[model samples]
Target: MELTLVDLSVARGGVPVLAGVSLSLAPGQALVLRGPNGSGKTTLLRTIAGLQPALSGQVTGAEDRIAYAGHADGLKAMLSVRENLTFWAAVFGMRDVEQAMQAFALLPLADRLAGTLSAGQKRRLGLARLLVTGRPIWVLDEPTVSLDADAVALFAGAVRAHLAAGGMALIATHIDLGLDAAVLDVTPYRVALNGVGFGSSDEAFL
Candidate 1:
């Protein structure tokens, strides 16, 4: 799959967060969106994922073409890991939740309540949900949060394998996800009150 962002900007409460950000991505590639807190990383990710509306510019990618993992795991607090995956699989119309559970190494925690799992475990479970969806583009927001080195490596390995399988990703991370992906910065594209948008700057978001 290929995605093109043409002069995209996002605003919250009428204050511009991201301004005139444009980029192109294709399968087997990854673009890291790196920035400090409140620098529009999350906003950009949300816009790309269609969770948030774009203030200006155009987002023409297929709506279901991308799967998003936000800062929150978005797991059902009352459900067990297995039940959560099962629910998501059914929601996404997957035929096999067990396959996805095993893929993410959640077999052991299948019976554990999602709310009771550690942060790392929860993040892994969240990532597992993405696998079950089978979408080609992954929009991850701080996917490594609360993960230990080993889990981080596991996440990175999963990402590498995805890219190898012709998948693409857009990651917004404060910590290194170790994906060897290219970086893009939204700082240079911040919308000024009087500017036309994406005004000819090439600041790196990574």
Candidate 2:
């Protein structure tokens, strides 16, 4: 399967941020998004992941095929590390969390409450959720935040494994994970304030 974004335009906070963006990702490929702080990388990723709507164009082959990991870790602080993975695993119709735990080295802290773990540990646990997703497309935003070098390497290894298994990834991060991935800079796609652009009143949904 292929994830294709054709002539896509996206907005944030009721204002157009990006326009005329297009890209495609087939199995075993990874695409890294690069842009300045307000360039709409997050907006584009959200649109592709189906978390938000695109003002124009089309996103195909992504329905029920994406596992998104945004800036927020999406963890249940009250749940134990293992329990958290179990919850997410079950949500995606999976039952085993052992492989996910080992992929991120969470076995040692399996019983620890998610809220008690350090920022890096929490991030690791958050990322481990992708392994249990069983989805072929990974849409990640700054996934390495708070992770140490070792943890980043672990995450990179996991991504490599995923790609080797014919999965695709669309990531927005500044750090280099050393993957043979294509980089797409969104700066060129930034919509001019005075230019004709799509508009929306849904300012509350960023």
Candidate 3:
């Protein structure tokens, strides 16, 4: 499978953030987006995940095959660790959460409420859902925010296995992901901050 963007333009709050961006990724491949803060990395990832739309241009190969994990853990505080994964798995038409638990070292805390887990644990639980979602393309935004070093390694291993199994990942992160992937600097795609949106015909260029 492949995900490709052609001259994509994206916006937030009805204002353009990224413009004329293009990239492609194949199975068993990853693209690590790196840029200074406010460079539109998150907007780009959200567009690819279908959570948001591109203002202009096209995104192909990412129709119904995306599993997006954003900065928030997205867990129900009252739900147990196992229940959390199970719920998402079922929502995605998957039936197993065992592998997800084991993948993120969450089995020990399976019955623990999500609200009680430490930040690192909660982050792992969030990541574990990716496996159960059973989607081929993973769109991750700042996936390692609160993880410890070992947890980060585990996350990297899981991503490696997914890619090895012909999955694709598009990650927006500032920290190292400990993977071999292409790095895209989004600075150039950032829309000018001169009070003009992609809707404007005459605007400043950076």
Best by TM-score: 2
How does each model score on lDDT? 0.80, 0.92, 0.88
lDDT tens digits, residue span 1-206, model 1 = 48889988887556676777889898899999866555677778888889778889988764788899987799998999999988888888886788667766789999999999988899989998888788889999888888888888778888888899999988887667767789987667655646433322212221
Candidate 3 lDDT over 78-176, as tens digits, reads 999999999999999999899989989999999999999999999999999999988999999889989988998999999999999999999887778
Q: By descending lDDT, how would the candidates be arranged?
A: 2, 3, 1
Model 2: ten consecutive residues of lowest lDDT: 197-206
- Measured with C-alpha atoms, the lDDT of residue 104 in candidate 2 is 98
The TM-score, computed over Cα atoms with residue i paired to residue i, of candidate 2 is 0.94
Tell me the spans in candidate 3 whose CA falls farther than 4 Å from its real position: 196-206
In model 1, the runs with Cα more than 4 Å from the true position are 192-206
In model 3, pairs of residues that clash are none
Reference-based TM-score of each model:
0.88, 0.94, 0.93
Give the poorly placed runs of model 2, Cα more than 4 Å off: 195-206
